[model samples]
Target: MSEPLVVPEVRRLGPARLTAGMDRWDRLDFAAHRRTHGPLPRASRSELLAVADRIDLRGRGGAAFPFARKARATLGAAERSGRAPVLVVNGAEGEPPSVKDATLLARAPHLVLDGVTLAALAFGAAEVVVAVASGSAAELSVPAAIAERGRDPVPMRTLCVPDRFVSGESGALIRAVNGRAALPPSRPVRAAEGGRGGVSGRPTLLCNAETWAQLALAARLGPDAFAVVGTPDEPGTLLVTVNRSPRPPVVVEVPAGASLAVVLDACGVDPGAGVLVGGYHGAWLPPHLAPDLPLSRTGLAAAGGTLGAASVVALPRGVCALAEITAVAGWLADESTGQCGPCRRGLPETVDALRALSRGAGSASAVRRAAALGRGRGACAHPDGVARFVLSALTVFAEDIATHASGSGCGLSSGLTLPLPRQAGERLAVDWARCAGHGLCASLAPDLITLDPHGFPLLRENANLAPWQRPQARRAVARCPALALRIGR
Candidate 1:
């Protein structure tokens, strides 16, 4: 049986942006939302853009791109191309360490839907799509919220995309929406440029679920009121998922310039241990590095990290840093889309090297070499992100690496404190005992299969195929003459 999904407790500190009314026992339905927070104010596209610029609102997604700039660019592209744009609300919280999006979606679904409606009206969009991961709490909550509204000015719908790590990426999400494999394209193309035939197959105004919720609040509160609590550069409350502590992980809404030390303490975590700021694709910082830094993107960047998705994972004192990093690296390797040679080849090798180093059997040079091979060489940022994460681990735990390299390693711990999911999709196995080496699988599905030193097919560690790739994978399975390959969930 599947484990019961634990809904994280919600805590609001400082001024609330997207997380207002979350303390109430009842879910904030449409009527209660309007009664509690007032109606969402309408504004012209240019006016909304001006407010966004004034507030310096950035995407709550990992990238932290300026929301005003994105809106203006997408609107400009729509006008130039004479095509209607589509507004997408991205609620796919695929990052295992982050639960802020899910918290907001489950507790305050109307707020998000209100933001979607306001954005659609501002962009003059005829259709809006709320995209969530299949079987996620947001998948059910969003549609119910939409139904509660009775009628919307623009038609709005919800779609469930594959829940892979890269699948939530903007390019991959767009590809999935366009009926293709949920993988990023080799070339960089903005969704704004090509209109209906572009990267998203439309001039799409796709923003994070939290970003939309922020927009909804911004519309109601206006710029001055919205800018009251946060720092000048990053003004507003940010929802952060705090984990790796003794207490259950909670999603807290904190002001932009709040002290990281205080936030960690509030989340029932010791502030003296190392912290993984941002999600898996982010960096690690010593306890001292975070105390003085504000929780804003600029502050975190100044302290050698980005506030990506506002996920703060406090490393416990006794946990093995090297083992934690190794497990995360292995999970990331398995999550790769296998669309690029660098990601497909370098990540697994990096995982292997890290595993060996964790066990005190491998050289640090091997880990570094494998990590370097992945930098800046993939269709998407997957390889670059993995490289950054691994390199950061090496740098932050240099002493650990040295000690482990000497062959007197830290003993393996019985449990993992890291937040990787227990189950990461399905597995593709090759029965090495059953058949002779054959290269047919590699040729049939090069993107999913590779050849090792002995010419045996090296199936990707996780056999989770995107919806569009299933038919080709099935064909490859059918043609395997040795009948030595099988898939298991």
Candidate 2:
């Protein structure tokens, strides 16, 4: 399958670090990459570890975990087990709206390779595996980049996995590389621990594409130089996926402490509709605090948000917030693999509650409660992520939720701003000619259908289904007494 690799529009605060050379949209070839960033340098394990510490480097793949500490733990485990470590580069970007990782793996492949080579050499890695989405452009781009570097210090191979959310989990990624199912293991295990669960049971160091790129930049710039751009505690730059929704997301580089308000204004997004600080697993920034919030992990945390994967989405005025939230929630629910009790049962119910709340028939507390049920019960972070996303939406857009639940809906259609693999656009319609006005449909789908004084089911104009509403709408159709309720295009 041929997937279109849409190169996102690029923006930068001061100077472009990650997106250094290419004056054009072309991928930076080996020659161009070397010419632009100079030759890749070598570093000892201790040297690289000190560099990570000096820069306070954090992984860019949602968690913002300290890369240096993670590296130390991996190194310690490898030494204790008398096994050389394995290096794994995770380019299996599962977030549909995010292209930050893809931007690095597909465009500036050498920059990321430089970091990979450095890490592999430092830790004496046995082999390196690069995992990308099966049909994504990275599938082609990464292998081509490896071929360019013919005589790498570490032997390299690229494996492809389905680009699903859980497929990016550490254990799941390693499993996929070893030709096993790309699902999180039943027991929790870190790649560093290297049980039989991780790739080939050897100690492994797994980090996302952006984390490697960040390391490459830090190595090239040195500590003081790298610290010049960002905040006191957090240095270096961030590869932010700025969502211009309904259009391709823009991948921008901003100094770590750059103001969220400034980034939004520069990106031409008005945050009157509220701003999402992190990607889907992240929280919505309160509208009042967005202007003052910084882009670092600490800054967002202070404002009740996490800078997860650094995706910033500013909803436009007049779009239905509830509808957009339902779209993403529905996607998250589908991605859950029933790995645990709450994750298996809670996510779907959370989506249903959110859909009803959007239609003015459910309480905000019910949606939050359903979402909270999954907070810490899953074996992985899927349930927790879903809870964080839905609960934040309920808090950040409280006014919108109140308005919708009060039946004075904003009357705006779903902007379709949040991208999804499939748009469930089916609408609920009534076969008025066959209607006996028994009001059974109203009882069945009170969120969607209301009974008029004349006992006919009333639907809003252009009553299209958000992704989460399809199940309820279908059930109402099946159970309608007069055979009056139907769902269609």
Tell me the TM-score of model 1.
0.89
Cα lDDT tens digits, model 1, 140-221, are: 7777888888889999888888777887888778777777876777666687665433544568888889998888888888
Model 2 lDDT tens row, 358-470: 77888898998899887877888888888888888888888888998997886877767776776455788888798898888777675567788998888844445644356
Q: Which candidate is the best by lDDT?
A: 2
List the candidates' TM-scores in order.
Answer: 0.89, 0.85
Give candidates' CA RMSD values in order: 3.7, 5.9
Model 2 C-alpha RMSD vs. true structure (Å) is 5.9
List per-prediction Cα lDDT, in the order shown: 0.78, 0.82
Model 2 segments more than 4 A misplaced: 1-5, 423-489
